[model samples]
Target: MKLPVLVLCLVATAAAAPLALAQTPIDPLDARDVRRLDKMEQVVRELRAIVFQGRDIGKPVVVQPAETDYQLQEVSRRLADLEQTITRMTGDLENANRQAELAKRDAEALRTENRSLSDRIASLESRALAETVAPPGGLGGASSGLSANDLFSEARQALTSGDYAAAESGFREYVDAYGDSSKAAEARYWLGKALTARGAHADAAGSYIAAIRGWPSTSWAPDAVVELSRSLIALKKPADACQTLAEFAKRYPKASTTVKTRAAQARNQAKCAA
Candidate 1:
């Protein structure tokens, strides 16, 4: 009876083991999860040791949470994204700076080109003015057997007679032949008047500038400056016109009433400030 009872008990135990395994099935864990569980178990063991060891041992134990590691990884990823964004912004800023520098260089180049063009135009006008007044046979033929005074007098008479063409020709000839003469400045002034009458304001300005180079105290000096300002105004150079007028009082304080009146008129036309 005892042997049969033992056998029945062993069979009952075997049947209960299968039923328990079937009722509570074990979920399969991957390698990563198994490692995480191992690490957590190790941390728990360390914490248990620290708690059991008592405060008098003075040993410190650090426990890190699995969630804290995930948070650190997320923060690291965000930091990497921010670094990439900053690098892109830095590249954009550098590109903008390069474009600005290029634009500055372009503007400077344009200004230089404009100045060169202006100089070329002025030179061409001067050459044209010389060609217009110079005779085909040159100064030798037109000014032949004529004294400097005679040529100067003829040019003045031609101007008075409203013969601008003849006056311009005669004056240009006189200037070329007797540039060192005392009447050269006067000739330049008359040449400017002829050019102004011909609507060559740019050329007229040039001649006026030459005439007043020394700021001579001659009777015509004040008038020449006034005429220069007028020519500058016609050439659409109000700033230069205003500057010329500003110097009038200093250069010709004792100028005649007529010349002063003309200077004032030029200033008004140029819209110069007081």
Candidate 2:
């Protein structure tokens, strides 16, 4: 009897377990929970699609946020601006370098021209000196035997004969030997004329300056001043030439018509003010 009772109890417990489970209340999901589940489902679908696409294409998967495209665009714009700035700076630097090179070349050209001019002047001076020594037993070689008056006469004769080299040597000797003599100024004037004929304008200017010292009262004084002005003009010193001419009218009021005419010509050459 106990065995039948135990079998019936076991069957009743088994049927009541199902009834208890059927009576339990299940809580439905809220709106927030439903939205969260939907978002998770969409993300899972996208990830699966990306994985499948990457496997098919044999390329790596790259998942970017929504703002990443905008950030990349901003970085690209900044890089473009930087590239433009670098291009402008490079152009400016190249222009500066080109200008500096041009300036350096110009300076070198000017230096070369100046050196050539100096060499030409020195060659002319050497030629003049060589000519002075060329004549056999000429004024310079035989000058020791001649008296001062003889030397002056020979130099004047050489000048009149257009023998400029002998004249220069003789006159140079006369001035050196008799600088304190009465004809010293005249000798210097003649020396300046010979130097001028040889295109030695710088040396001629010095000789003329020495000849016109103290503004002597001789007849040649006005002519010396005019010749000095001419030499100054040759030296590209127009201002100094004009200044020398200005003193001519005041210093030599009794200047000859020939000298006055020469002075007028020099004034025109120098473009002196009236």
Candidate 3:
């Protein structure tokens, strides 16, 4: 009876797999889950040989043999183990899906900002061109009246194109020239990314910390939280990394899906418990 009950549970879970797929992210069954299912299949085969073939289909299979009861207990234990693992895995999948959605939204936001910055840059250049016609050095000066958003977007483009040094310089200049600009927080965050890309984790952590402290309310601040943790990890400061991640949820109560996911992962990397 216990053997049939266990097999039925396994079959029920298999039937519900499609619903899980719809609710969770892409991977419904990880390697451990696959291995556990394989083990369940083998257990079912053993039960079929031991008790299923000789039993009446609708009757309660009360096994009299002590050895058969032991087998039943073992199968039941395995089933319970598999069930618990599946529960945890489902939670992880859902979290991953949320992160993916957040990343998609973030990308769209970046595209929109880029377009807006480009329009402003065009307008600024037009005015600069008119001014340059009257004086040869009018628009050529470093003080040529470009907005912070325009300069930040250009530096971001260079970063996207893998020009780390150019990106770093541009970001630094923006931070220095427009420290009070709405985009300065993001610029500091990207400066950290640029520095980290060049194997300067120590310097990168400083920029990331600045991003967090200077623009804690900005959208990029949450991302800076995760990046700061990662930079600490690179500096062989696992405890500090874990500490930074520990405060993530509290600091950024409304962090994006991806930022939350990355925070969890960074905590794991730091070997944080609970």
Candidate 4:
């Protein structure tokens, strides 16, 4: 009977232990509160990422008013300098263009005048050929004749070759040796040309006068008359130049452009004197 009672007491103790475990209490708010704490921790971590990105990784730049104003002032100053330099360059270019135009006009006028003079010389040369006379001497001073033509040709050769002393001597010999020959007129005229080349304007004027008077019927007379006036002008004798030019015009009304050019030059001297 005591053994049966001990077995029954063990069974009863085992069953009571299972029932107490099943009846233990559970907290309903504990799971919800834990979930809420986890959500709060996630939100804090997201906020830290946004703050770090904005402050440490890629922050917006703030401009200072003073720096902005200084940059604007520098740009304005540079623009002003550029404008002034452009204006000065424009003025210089305009001046250069004006000068170029003036030079072009002068060159054109000279060309026209040269063409006219060339035509006139061609006509005069044709007329002179018809009335030309042979010099007493040939090209050389071989014989006793020794005319002005030989000496003049030699002088021209010398002058062309830049031998001034020989040219002067030859021209002087021409005037002395053949004063009465028709070729003497040409010699005397060329002597004046040679003298002028040697910078002896006073002597040149005298020789030109002698040439004109020596051969009034020859073609060289009109040219000599004009040349004498030009020589006088070169000598700064404007009064004499005017008188000689007046005589030339009276003597040769239908003179060539070369003669007219000398007359015009004489008038220029007279005007300068005035």
| Top candidate, metric lDDT | 2
* Candidate 3 per-residue C-alpha lDDT over 1-274 given as tens digits, one digit per residue, 9 for 90 to 100: 3455665666566557669868988757899999997887676565555454545564565545458888999999999999999999999999999999999999999788656644543443344334321112211123666666777877798899999887887787787778788777788789889988998887787777767763367768888889888988888988767667766776788998888998888888889767
lDDT by residue (tens digit), candidate 4, 135-205: 34323443445545566778788878877667766766665566667677677677677778788777676
Clash pairs (backbone) in predicted model 1 = none
**How badly does each model clash, as a count of residue pairs?**
0, 0, 0, 0
The deviation in Å at residue 118 for candidate 3 is 40
| Candidate 3 displacement at residue 186 in angstroms | 1.5
Model 4 stretches with alpha carbons more than 4 Å out: 1-149, 160-162, 272-274
By TM-score, the best candidate is 1
Q: Could you arrange the candidates by TM-score from highest to lowest?
A: 1, 2, 3, 4
TM value for model 3: 0.46
After superposing candidate 2, which stretches have Cα over 4 Å from the reference? 1-138, 141-143
Question: Candidate 1 — worst ten consecutive residues by lDDT sum?
Answer: 134-143
lDDT of each: 0.77, 0.79, 0.73, 0.66
